[model samples]
Target: MKVLRRWTAALSALSLLVVALPASAAPATRWEPCPVAGSAERQECATLTVPLDHRDPHGRKIDLRISRIPAKGTSRGALVIIPGGPGNSGLNRPSTVNFPAEIRESFDLIGFDPRGVGQSSPVSCGMAAADARRLTPWPGPDGDISENIATAKRMSEACARNGGDVLRHISTRNEARDIDEIRKALGRSKISYWGLSYGTYVGATYATLFPQRTDRVVLDSSDDPDPRRVARGWLANYAVGFEDRFPDFARWAADPANPLRLADSPDAVRPLFLDLAAKLDRAPQDWPGAVPPKLNGNALRETLLRGLSTDAGFPLLARTMAAARDGSPAPVPVLPPDAVLQNISAVAAATICQDVTWPRDIDRIARDVQRNRARYPLTAGMPANAGICSSWPHQPAERPVEVTSHGPANVLLVQNRRDVATPLSGAWKLREAFGRRAVMVTVDAGGHGSYLATGNACGDTTVTKYLLGGARPAHDLHC
Candidate 1:
């Protein structure tokens, strides 16, 4: 009876939007083998055609590339997988993620390329290689944002010229709408969701907008659902997030068994890194093959942020840090060529700027940077720094989604304790937003991504059980 009530209410909200019929949009026979390797051979691929603007159902259309690994056993429905990176091609997830046996047995593991990403109607701003460096979100070492400000304006203008109308529509809300369109195309009245990173924000918004349509939603590594801040806030929180995650790196770097020991004790590691960055700021080094080929303070800081995502990245960061200190050549990680970044940077800029308005006032931002630098020396005010969003071409399309607990209690929220990207504090904010509608599982783990990435048996098992058997804990549980 309770499920019926929820279903009815969901259909009521969904009625406001035009729902595609399966036979017309996609046929079961349309499934073809996916092109990516390592994925199960039976995995099928398809394209979903959706409107560029949800407001005009009969307008310009875009194709969303999608893939699915069919269930080998009893099926509940489709478990739509939302990938991270407002820029990731979800269609390729099966190639990397080894979905556990239970989920594979119970539901069709599905993925898709959100609009304006890989294989979809892709967009790029044509930003130069040099422009990418000048427009990094972090301010100059001396808190000078003048160059960053000018570069951002040029980048924003390029995107406006190159991106056209697509830029305005690449937002979380539209992404959620695209998900619903996929759900309808699959002939499912209700569907389950497993979203990670930015995907979590996408899942939460989907639940709030179409509660009845949601079944067994799992939001891993969540961000704060504060409507006002959006992606701008996520960039700023890097200061706090990095401080929380860097210690784990320090301990690992200082370990006796570790080949790359940067310090004698974990306590020594923080100062050692800070000193290294300061020295690099004063005297930059040249690496013939690196992205900029010149290692400066900002590059080191960027490297630190990069390494804190997972412990797997620790050794790489440490080795590079040591090489920079000793003036020895390090195998600097190659960034994806500028051509790829053009697509990535444009999508990132569009989704963030179109989702919420960023303050364009340089004076105010510079003051904040200095204040942030003083408070969090480890991150050096990079978190509070501005990016191209400050000079974004247009105002936000709509207000940011205010996530509420008014939806069905079908959510399982998973979070890591020491995430440098989506910190537990931010996850707690999302948990609070979900209210009575969700049960959270706080994993006693570190790193940015939880679930399989953390390798926490307790966290993964708890989530997998609920996903496989639609049973959630009565209250929030700690692993």
Candidate 2:
């Protein structure tokens, strides 16, 4: 009776939108072998055909590449694993993720490449490798964003010239729509989900748009779903995120016993890093084969941000920092293939820009940068500065979807307390938006991802229990 009531209510809400459906009931997704070496041999692949524009569902169609690993025994249901990066590939996730035996046996693990990413009707900005590497929009020396503004304008024009029609439709809302299509194609009435980073936003949007269809949901490393800001807020969060997480790195780097120690104490690490950055700003060191072939202040800052994602990267970061301080040749920057970088850059720009319009007022952006730089010296003003979205070619076709507490109380948000990408502050906002519909488990850990990644027994067990038995705590938990 409860299920029927929820379903009816969801149908009534969906009726407000032009629900895209095929002319005739579409057949169940046919799977074919697409195995990943050294992993699951039974991993199957398939393609989903969805509309280019949800409003014009019948107008044009695009393909989404999907992959799945079937449940071991009698399946409980399907669990879609949505990866991070408005730009990361998801097709190999089912085989790659180290799921517990129970989870592997209980659910058919599924993953998909969102439109304009990976093998799903890929789009490109035709960006040079160097431009793609510098997508984060680092401010010039003296906190000037003139170069950042020019880069934004140039990148925006490049995308407009090369990104085609699909670029315009690549957005969080549409990704939610596509996930619904995936659900329909699977012939499931409801689907379980595990979403990481930006995927958490997509999952939140889906749960909002189609509440009844959501079963067990675990959102890891959540983003702030502020309708007015969205991606802009996520970028700006790096300032707070860096501040929250850098202390962990500093503590690790300052240990006397550690071979890569940069400072004698944690208190000294911050000044040392700032001094190195200032020195680099005045004189960048040349590397033989890096993108720009120079280790500048911005590049060092970028490296620190990446290094803060996980504690495991601390050694390499310490080595790099030590070399920079010692006036030695910097390590070569590791980068993905040029083609992959272009795809990521295009999709990231399209998604961020199309999801919502960024503030275009140069004066306001510059002022924000100055203020942000003053408050958070570690991340500089990069987080608050303008990017390609500032000069986006088209305004969003619709306003950003607001995640609310109207959905069924089925969400379990598990987050690390100090994440360098998605900090606890933003996670709290997402949790507040979900209200009665969600219960967040705050892990007393540092880094980007929580759950199995963090090895927090309480956090992992809580999520696994929800996934398997549909159980949740009466209130928010501090694991």
Candidate 3:
């Protein structure tokens, strides 16, 4: 009687499985000839409709502008490229960014504008560039919080008034769901992801929730996947991150061979920078039409921060510094176009504000800023300072995804030794969460993203070997 009962149960499971399988999968994306100038490889563009709110799948929908460069031959699967910047779009990575063409040719290079970014249904907070510049995560030069607090509230209000319901739904979880929807739309069961900077957090969240759906995952220049930190932590780390990455710039600037040499020695570079900033703070350059309309000390500081993001930016910083010191007409500052800035700021603010609640208390923020200044003067207490999120109108729609090591063993983390934005320390925290599941390739280089830029040949080779040939180092390998 017992054997008969077990057989009946097993037969019932088989019957359910047979009935559950779909006769045919969802329709594949229709391919078209997309001729983009300056692109040597064949590329195509299309849109996939995803829910604005995943909770109501049948409700309103938004188009995700997805681009793909199909493989030259038989493909492994779709290699989705996730761009950095909570505001950055992946839509141009395959063709625009300097991703290795050899690896790109091995698989379908897929890029998409995450919900409110790029060619997708973009959202704007209607913020002027001037207003955006004033609202800093960093406090004022003297650690004054009055303006910072006001800006925070004003910025939050601007977002609340300008960014509507769609803003509330732009969390990492929703983005991950959208990714799965893209997978379904493309008729793929699994996908390989290559995420940079903030995209690392997004990719990690996707892996946490849909482990089985991930393949050949590469998190380059990772953020602290800490639920409490989220964007808050990334914002705060600018101070520390700049400190870590600036030294590399200093050494390069000190090199006499460089046309835009700053100082005689690496030691002189640091003090020269500090002195220049202080002098400028007292009296800004008379340049017009720049971000602040005058090249102030903070403007120089901000340029330094961006310059240190990668090794390629070293010259920009040195030349700018040289020109400023020489009292030459300041080079025209090139900020993103107005429309692009609006879209980016809206997405960045909404994502930060909606992901989790930042401290609303001004006193605590002020104190943190004070401490931050004393400890790290490069950013002058900005990282610890409050911004728009402090006074965000709505509550978080969902909890931050807790990244764990429970996912498939296909995760690979490639990091630079001294990245200012996503430092090695934070990457270690992410590595700890993933435990043995992720094998890290720490390159002995100083830049934000490791796979291609600023990374040594070994690091790029390792990542390419993994993405193309499905090979991962047996252990954490330092290149």
Candidate 4:
């Protein structure tokens, strides 16, 4: 899940499986050239219709946009590419992402826009642009959440008013079911998977629900798969994740050769950033072309959240911080189209909110925020603050899927030690949940995704070897 201002930031299960139709009764998928420009000639697009509610297999149906890049050599099977964000589109990944030649040649790479995303029957809350920016409940400069509570109520009401039945049915468990449908459509009983960020959870859920159907599974940058906490835990992790990842940026920002250097030493960097954020809270700088049109403390924090995801983004973040600290002309923040944001916000709200129940008591939530603010000043308690889910009109369609070590030992977990979004601590929880069923490779690196990212040769080699050949270290390995 990508960072959004305030609270909106961005699940799994199995029975269980949905009843399948006879092979002759199932619709035959016809693959045609993808409509996206610059898409590779090898890539083809198709649509698979899935039940809106898996329980009611014979009821209303929705289409999922899927893409595939056939193998270069004799294919072993399919490798499904799952994108992050309960909202991110995966249909173009088969063409956009550069996979190693060996892996691409060994299997047919597949991608899809999960239900309620992209061309897969998208949903919206009909929220005004301003309301969308208020998705996260960042407190006032004085640590007051009065406005945050009000914003939550408004956003919740808007979603209930505008989001249709599609929003109600959007969930992690359903997504796993959809993947199973894709497997059936492709005429494969078992498939390999490569999932990133939130996609890791989707992959885990698929593996748990259909353990027998998963061949080789790779979960990169995992989320804590605690069914009780669910998305709330992911949100709260930002407080610790930011602290863990900040030092890496601090080292880069304090380097003498860096043009955007903010301090003389790494130790001075944290104080500098905290002071700058406090100053922004008191007086926001005008930032044209950005959502809310101002560079406030939370806006700066959002920049940190995104920038810490990759080393390539460090300079952009440094530049933004330098501008804020010096009161220089604010860099114009590029934003996605309003329609895109609307769709993402709606899907994020629905999936996170309906995955599990949240505290409806404003006072209970307020206490949590206050405590979080005191302990972790960098995030300013936003991670602990309640969002639209607290006031969400609907309840979860089913219980959150508990991912246990009940499946095959085919799972491989790869992680960055200091990922800001999905931190190592949270990944550990997932690792423990998988138990002996999964082998973890923790890279001594920073940023979010790990495999082929962060340039850790050992981590990359371990994951590649696992995908190419079914080999994993006898125990959890640290690179």
State which candidate has the highest lDDT.
2
The local distance difference test score of model 3 is 0.79
What are the models' TM-scores? 0.93, 0.94, 0.92, 0.93
Full-model lDDT for every candidate:
0.81, 0.87, 0.79, 0.85
Across residues 173-266, which tens digit of lDDT does each residue of candidate 2 receive? 9999998877776656778999999999999999999999999999999999999999999999999999999999999999998988899899
TM-score of model 1 relative to the true fold? 0.93
- Estimate the TM-score for candidate 4: 0.93
Which pairs in model 1 have colliding backbones? none
Question: Which residue runs does candidate 3 get wrong by more than 4 Å?
Answer: 1-28, 134-136
Tell me the spans in candidate 2 whose CA falls farther than 4 Å from its real position.
1-26
Model 1: lDDT equals: 0.81
**lDDT of candidate 3 over 1-479, digit per residue (tens):** 00011222232345434333221222435545565678776777777777789888767777777778877666677889987778788886777767776776577888888989987778887876666765456465677878777877777788888887677778878888888876665556678989888889889989999999898899999898889878888887677687888789988999989888889999999888877887787888887767667777778887887788878888878877886788887666578888888788888888887888789888988898898888887887878987888888888988899999897889899999899889888888888889877999999999788887864999999999999888899999999
Candidate 4 lDDT over 1-479, as tens digits, reads 11111110000121112123222122346677775577554778777777889998767778888888888887778899988987888998888877888988888888999899988999999887887867667787857888887888889898999999999999999999999878776656688999999999999999999999999999999999999989999999988899999999999999999877889999998888888889999999998777778999988888888788889888888888888988886666566788998988899888899889988998888888889999999899999998888889999989999999997899999999999999999999999999989999999999989998888999999998999999988999999
Q: What is the Cα-based lDDT of residue 22 in candidate 1?
A: 29
Best by TM-score: 2
Each model's backbone clash number: 0, 0, 1, 6
